[model samples]
Target chain A: MYLRGVKELSLTRSEEDHIKAIHTLTRRDGRAATNAISERLSTKASSVTDMLKKLAEKRLLKHEPYYGAKLTLKGEAVALQLVRRHRLWETFLVDRLGFGWDEVHEVAEQMEHVASEKLVDKLEAYLGHPHFDPHGDPIPDKHGRIRQRKTKSLDSCGPGESVRIVAVSETTDGLLRLLDSKGLRIGTTLVVQEVHAFDGSMDVKPKSGSAFSLSKDVSDHLQVEPS
Target chain B: MYLRGVKELSLTRSEEDHIKAIHTLTRRDGRAATNAISERLSTKASSVTDMLKKLAEKRLLKHEPYYGAKLTLKGEAVALQLVRRHRLWETFLVDRLGFGWDEVHEVAEQMEHVASEKLVDKLEAYLGHPHFDPHGDPIPDKHGRIRQRKTKSLDSCGPGESVRIVAVSETTDGLLRLLDSKGLRIGTTLVVQEVHAFDGSMDVKPKSGSAFSLSKDVSDHLQVEPS
Candidate 1:
């Protein structure tokens, strides 16, 4: 299930989806409950229990009676495939389809299950092997390799520190609208000029070969390799 | 070539390649030269002439007393986009990757013309809405829509006339081999009959509910109506 790089991994789409849901839910909550999985997958709890057992047998998830399950290394492989395809497709949609960054995540979700290594390889080649997708998520290379980026929230940028935005989170159009109003986007160089403790927001500037200030909360989700 | 049932009448990848070359050459040869075009495309001269005149009045190819010029609205939209992506990557290979797709015609040649709709949608979806790439294929969807499908091939049926195999023209290793061997595949039916041919193909009995004979060609192509 864990493709070290780009060799094909064997698992059905549903299995991968279950693994991914577990991974996501685990990231949010401490454990992956059967109810949580049923809610995420829109399936009956009974069905989730059935799948939990099936995955446990495959050593994909460590299931504990009444508690839920944890993804084993084997399961992690499958989850990673969903992640890889998800980000890759997101990038392709926004970059190649003329989609706004806010519009790509959902579409990529559906496209991620397409079964074709050659298609993915060709896309990577066609795309110059991009390292990120539309929402600023890192794309796993054919080898499932990820570039370790040193980044923190825009909120973390101290006054007088220079920062350039590499990506924005695509959760809602609200973020996109806010950024657009502020002229902030990936690779936009903005320096922290001042932070108002009174309102948790700040003044911002664009990196258009110029200096500027930005609000603090908006900066939190934005990753900046501060200089 | 006109694909049956393709209402989308966009100039195909091959058609665009022909247009680009024809446009450039029409400036030479005193006009568009069919023989030269045939040499360029490695197709026959007669086919080139047929396509040239067809394109000319359509405004893609220019022809005057066997002489020619360039594109028109109907032609340039498709031609320019194809040219834009092809040259962008062709140039990118030499400039970025030390080695291209063979230095890349084998792959690029095919990719250069894959339907822009699919390419743009998938690319933007995967690449993070990159506005531009090293190759400069305009890295965004010039057109907003893409066509996605769930169709499969027809080579996986048993000795029967009506069993729908689902899926089509797969380039994968498992599928190609399976189809070649007349084993498990997609949308394929055996149509029970004793071909009793001299060329050594199997002839199975009972078209449905049982297995029988098959021709290699029949086993290789032919998609069935959906079941």
Candidate 2:
């Protein structure tokens, strides 16, 4: 069965990038501003505007000149497909190819553009249908349905609270490398030893390791769920 | 050690396609004519000329307007890399993903453009450094060295000769499906039972299956080595 929500449409690589960028930006904000898209794509604002107009003309999104762009349902499907392909390739690189998590994002970025539904389906099966990527981000299913979890940032936990890292909200290479060095990963359980209110830093003890202090920047990006 | 002969060069998809087409054409003919490349890429001869000029300026190839295009050493390296990637991906699709041999070429064509040297290296290692692809064609080594085999066509064999399928020189989907339906595959042993010289039809008995008649067209593309 074809599980994709919408029929696969042949889109230019640039168009797919804009759709994904809009999807990511619109998730946090209701609409994606041209400036935000330009920054995300590292393209000029004028180019983003032209692309937005084109995407709007294609009925993939709604664009307001001064406001922003929001995805249509059709556009969201395409975005989800890209996300699925990206996350799957990331999982393959890290889990199967033995690549370090920090080094997989760039390669996966290039691989996600291989536009074959059948290839993705076979890969999903080969990977045993992983629910989450290496970074703990939920992978959208074939129908664009993402598994939802209710989790808060690690910084929100109080002293004595126990939690398990579910996902990292920020996945910059620096952040990933920092977490790797700290022996932190998805599913790592920790007990909040102390919360430094002054700087929003926290001392957290891993289930197996000694307590370590995490700066506000690091702790803020760590999504956790009560253990 | 880096297995690739030349440092990876960033190439546009179209540039990669042209380079690959020239490589394939030049294999049969000393030089790749504009019309041949145009036909291979399904583009206009004028467009092909324009691209050849651009590629020549990039020093990837030498373009003689009337004599057709010939790859420089750098261009051949690029072409071999593309071939390596394509064959490796095709092997992955068939050996790991369970895709039919007849159905993997198109998908591999799309995947071959993922321009990450690390990814390809890891993939080659993951596949245990496969020497040949699913179609029994030699997969170029990381250093762009293809394993050479001395083999003749099945049609060249006379009655009483024992042979084994080494590679299918023609990998068209139709041809592969025909081979598949006939229980023929790489490494399958066969004994020539009779030859009908009038139309070059030959009856051959598989080591395991019943004897079958193969037309000259089919046998011509089957590369075989004496058992």
Candidate 3:
């Protein structure tokens, strides 16, 4: 992977957003389609195509028409920096500023674009270098090193098993608020009472809170490790 | 005065910089000249004129070709918000993140554009509602109420009078570094030993440090309260 100095990492807000969208899409589909990127950014496909070409010229990504795009090594490094900034700011917002997990994403989105290496370093030190954000997503370190965790979807656990929520994949504010209302969060332990094969929903009892039935959709979003 | 919601305060980076320049110049000269604003921003006079007209059309400023530009009430409010954000971020950098006073300005300049009112308010609370920034400039509150201080330039103090540093007006890094080298900073107390009529220079003795001489240019930048 290529590494770049902070000075060389200057990008407009739109460029950074496109790079991040491509990174996220690549993680899910192994390649990022122009249409998918456009959809992600709520922009037009033609505009996405134009941006893809510009990124290609800048050596951030490689794009082929009617096919897909992929972040180059240099591109991945930049994208990781953005991710690191985003998660670090989110951690600071929630841990230091008392913002709820659901409320930090938008503010962090703006903070991520500040892009000062020393500022980020100082902020990381100020926040005690948290390894994971409030949403349970691993925060990439300064060197783009992400802490790995062994976890599976809560929906995948069988009946009578105990697990601790490690991360939640679909991090919509609505989903996060729902989980909060249900007293489910990162590190919350649950004992599965039963999993209905027909509906794929499950009845789980939190170690402290009473049992609650969660739909397949909600359970699928939750990731857990054996307790 | 026209009060605006946070959403209506949207301004491009360049626009914000221009507004800030106008506000600063107005404070110093009572009117912001296009040439002065151009020089401050390092842009062309024609470009500054175009921007002035745009701002006038937006009701942020009133521009008279030869006279100068003046901010409307709406413009002053926006400028105050920008100042509030800048000082608040500078305070956060120095008071919370351990950044040196000389190094926080550029980062704060970028951060002031984030334009998230809630984020700013939370940050104010997190920083314990500091009334003055690290440089000793008053930080405006949410309603743009600025803390007032009685002060005079160090150069203006008579011989035999002692004063405590309250603020440094021309906040260039070179000047700050020079002040740092001389053990001069906010709250440093100095007694004027002599004032040379020849070149506006003076000899002074700090309360603790050895006596020293300062040029008029250097002394003029220092604001001090009678001690």
CA lDDT of each candidate? 0.61, 0.91, 0.90
Residue-pair clash count for candidate 1 = 63
Candidate 2 chain A, poorest ten consecutive residues by summed lDDT: A1-10
Residue B174 lDDT, candidate 2, scale 0-100 = 92
Q: Score residue A140 of candidate 2 by CA lDDT.
A: 90
Across B11-96, the per-residue lDDT of candidate 3 in tens digits comes to 78998899999999998888888899999999998999999888889888888888888998888888989999999999999989
Superposition-based RMSD of candidate 2 using all C-alpha atoms, in angstroms: 1.9
In model 1 chain A, the worst 10-residue window by lDDT is: A1-10
User: Model 1: per-residue lDDT, tens digit, A28-72?
Assistant: 687899998998889999999999899898777899989888988
Once fitted onto the true fold, the runs of candidate 2 whose alpha carbons sit more than 4 angstroms away are: A1-5, B1-5
Task: Give candidate 2's whole-model lDDT.
Answer: 0.91
Say which candidate scores most in TM-score: 3
Worst 10 residues of 3 chain A by lDDT: A1-10
- Cα TM-score of candidate 2: 0.96
- Chain A TM-scores for all candidates read 0.80, 0.96, 0.97
lDDT at residue A185 of model 2 (Cα atoms): 91
Q: Is the docking of candidate 2 incorrect, acceptable, medium or high quality?
A: high
Model 1 global lDDT (CA atoms, 0 to 1):
0.61
